[model samples]
Target: MSNLLWLVPVLPFAGFLILALAGKHVSRVWVAIIGAGSVSLSAIIVLMIGIGFLLHPPATGNYSQTLWTWMQVAGFNPKITLFLDALSLVFVFVITFIGALIHIYSVSFMTGDKDYSRFFACMNLFVFSMLLLVLADNLLLLYLGWEGVGLCSYLLIGFWYESEVNGYAARKAFIITRIGDTAMAIGLFVIFYQFGTLAIPDILAKAPVLWQQGASIATITALLLLAGGVGKSAQLPLQTWLPDAMAGPSPVSALIHAATMVTAGVYLIARMHVIFQLSPIAQMIIAVIGAATLFIAGFSALTQYDIKRVLAYSTISQIGYMFLALGVGAWTAAIFHFMIHAFFKALLFLAAGAVIEALHHEHNMFKMGGLKNKLPVIFWTFLIGSASLAALPLISAGFYSKDQILWYAWASEGGNPWLWFIALLGAFITAVYTTRMMIVVFWGEAKTEIGHHPGKLMTVPLIILAFFSLFAGFIELPHNFGHFRLFSDLLHHVLPETVLKAGMDAELQFQLLALLSTFGGIYLAYVFYYKQPQRIEKLRQSGFVMNLYLFWFSGWGFDKLYNVLFVRPVVFIANINKNDVVDKLYQGVTFVTIRLYRSLSFTQSGSLRWYVMGLVIGAIIILSIQIML
Candidate 1:
């Protein structure tokens, strides 16, 4: 069963190839099966292997399968290998299983589209790439998967290529992430140069022995990797692409932006935890970046009227929490939150998709109202997701995971007072924006009629995801509550043990603080958006608040900043070089050659004698040059 791990990623790629080649010729019904069925089969295989892992675990708690020799040279060998352990298993199950669910939802979401086959093709390929990323045994293979997801993102985000705006958004995502990918590629080269191996386990084992704590080399490598993660996960500065990515289909938003692809960065740092642990500086930077991103994105989420854009900012903020956990040495807490985030965020996006489709692509939350009665399924399911996202007390999975990260941010060895405050504030912002989104989109007066209801295919996935969003955290309950840390304990072999600097009493205190923050934010949102809607209108009319709103609404102007600092300069240089100065020398030579030929044209004035004389002169000139040499 373990040896068949290769099938997990292979199934999705096979699905992609089939759909990509013949999907257009076939009916939409078959396209749906080929797209969704492929991922469903992959999920089944992963479940079987996951069961095997539980029943008969490997000696090292990891199993590696080398499919074939991929490439080999002197002192270099990288294989087409797949690894299965608690860590990769978690990621694979999430990618295939949750991914399968999203794919299923997309079938109904994209039923009538002309580009349905193309959309599914990109979607299937994305799952394949993500599976490869998690299952990879070596850095090279992982990078292939990493870049593969990036390409798939561009294709899917711009799936409706007829739209010029979508094309720009897709290009923006590609170019921004490519910056970090370049850095990661360099890091890969450095790792190969320093350690003489690209295998993940080998690198982990060798890095500590070869490099000291706080080593510059290790710090550099860690930072480079963090850059890649930051870009992929939609962290600070690099996050501008995600909201714009909402230009794509809602299923694309749900699958790539919410669930699988956005979490790729978290997986990278966790997979290479040794490097981060060795460089305290690198870890500190990770925490700080996470802290800053959450705040920026949190505030940004507050001002968004676009339903999908609000969730996009919320996704960025949530990933910041994951980053903060990684920085504070709560590695398992980070991944635990990542898993939970996937469930709820995907649910929210899908629900939002249904709402948008029902409204004929209306995205503004302010323009949408009183959907609770009209679209009861979407309203209820979206509420569950939003409640989980807001960390609404002990009932939601988010409270369990987020509370751990906040407590750890304050209580871990690497934690500081400031980190905790920032996270707490971000949590407040998360709750506020989530409540605001739900109130505006679901509650209040009706702004439009619902033309259609989401079919069973869409609603079923939401119900399944909503169940997970509410209860998945039970798998990793805090020690203060009881001994239900099954999620972390399962991955104990892969992750280092986490300790709270402040013990159980402090744990309860942080939990209280988290609870308070969640309620405070929710209360504020309810008061502002729900109970007294006119107050929101009045506040919007104020010059100061409106200015503040506009600032945050523009994603803190990062896009404009990048455009001025990077994009505009590049475009300017490209324009200036459109007719390159370097070409002048060649142009001058052509001009002179033309003139010389014209001057010599008189020599062709009609005669065998003139031709013979010209031939004789050419031969003499060649003879003279040879004699001189």
Candidate 2:
């Protein structure tokens, strides 16, 4: 099983290579099969291995396979290795499983796309990179996967090359993420400098020893790691790129935003939980940032007109909840939430994509109404997804995971009452916006013609994901209700058990709180959007609120803020250096030399006699100087 782990990533990479190298000549059906089949095969491999691990658990609760010695120096060596433990197993399952479904859905979603081959190629490459990221044994290998995924993201986001706006969005996503990648690289260097190793396990082993020296260094390193996570996860100041990322095809959005790329940050933090455990300050910082970002993104999702943008903001906000879970020392719960979120979020995005495709690329929610009847499969699947995302009590997967996070936030040792309060508020807002989006898009009167119905290929994945979204949470119900701890118990072997533990009564409080927030938000959404749908117009009528709404709709003006703060300044500096510095200095030097040569041309006089006289004089002077020397 260990040796076979490489095959999981290898199959997708091979598919990418084949499609890229010979796609133009290949039939579209073969291309679709190759693209989706590779991932499906990998998912099967992952499932078999996961089942193997579950049945015959490793004594150490970890497994590793070393392919080769990646690098070696006197005292340092990093191997090309893959680690399959509980945490990485979860990631592998999500990447290949959700990734495969998205690939399948893309077949129909992108049927007539000019760059269908190119799109699948990029998707395959992304799956390979994401798998490599999770399965990597060392930080360097992980970074390689990291950059690989980033490259694929840029390519896929700009897959429709004819669209200038898509190109711009791709560039923006790449550049913004590179900023955090740079910081993450620096943090990796810091890790190597202090520990003399780049292997994750080795660094983790040494993290405590380094932390024993001082809290300051631990906090700094942790913060730097958090910066990288923030950029990748689309958290807070670095989140602007995610909303704009909707320029890509819907499956790409589902793949990147919901299932794979953006989740890289959460995976990174979770993978490095050993180092994070040493820094309470860093953990607190994570909690605060997560709480703040959840609300920020939740509010932003409320005002989005574009259907994908609403989902995009919802992804960011949901990730914020995951980070909040990690911040409050609920590692297993965070991973649990991430898995459940992937299923439903991908389902919603893909369903929205089908609607967009059916409406001839109409993405505005106002243009869509009464789609429930026109696209029944999409309507039902999307409802399940939205209900899960809105965390509608015991039936929704999100409810279980989110409740655990909130429980830990309030009950954990370092958990703050204030942070928990903000998180609950965000949850309420999430339910409201999600319900608002669903009602406005699917329930109202049909405002536009449905150009076509989504084919079976697209709807099948939606049904599967919707099923998971509705029931995946049962794997991690709180211990209070029959003391079920299957998920936590499985994770304990891989993750260091945090000291903070929720009692039965505390768990019950969390369930009640989650239920209230979920129901309250849903009711509020109903009253506002269903009962008094006209009230939405009234809210839009107020200039101040409308402006605020517009700001949120535009991702809280973060795109403009980033341009002003980073992009514009960089462009300004480049222009100044190009025009004022390099051009003037280089051209001035060349001009002066040319002028000096021209001035000396007078000595030639363009006459044979004068040239001979000058030569003779110059020779005499040179001879005299040589003689003196």
Cα misplacement distance, residue 230 of candidate 2 (Å): 0.5
Put down candidate 1 lDDT per residue, 499-586, tens digits, no spaces. Answer: 6666798889889988999999999999988888889889889999999999999988888898899989999999888768687778
Best by lDDT: 1
The number of clashing residue pairs in each candidate reads 0, 0
RMSD per prediction, one decimal?
Answer: 3.5, 3.5
Model 2 regions more than 4 Å off: 73-75, 499-502, 588-629
lDDT value, residue 464 of candidate 2? 97
Off by over 4 Å in 1: 589-629
Clashing pairs in 1: none
Model 2, 1-629: lDDT tens per residue? 65688899999999999999999999999999999999999999999899989999988777888889976788678888988889999999999999999999999888898888989999999999999999998999999999988998899888876889999999988988988999999999988888888888888878887576337778888888899899889998888888888999999999997667899999999999888888888888888888889989999998888999999989999999889988888788889999999999999999999999999899999889888777889999999999899988888888888887887778887577898888899989999999999888998888889888888999999999999999899988876767677888889866754565656887787789888998999999999988998887898899998899888877777788877988799999988887787688999999999999999989867889998898899999999999999
Q: In model 1, which range of ten residues has the least summed lDDT?
A: 493-502
- Angstrom error at residue 65, model 1: 0.7
| Positional deviation of residue 229's Cα in model 1 after best superposition, in angstroms | 1.1
lDDT, model 1: 0.91
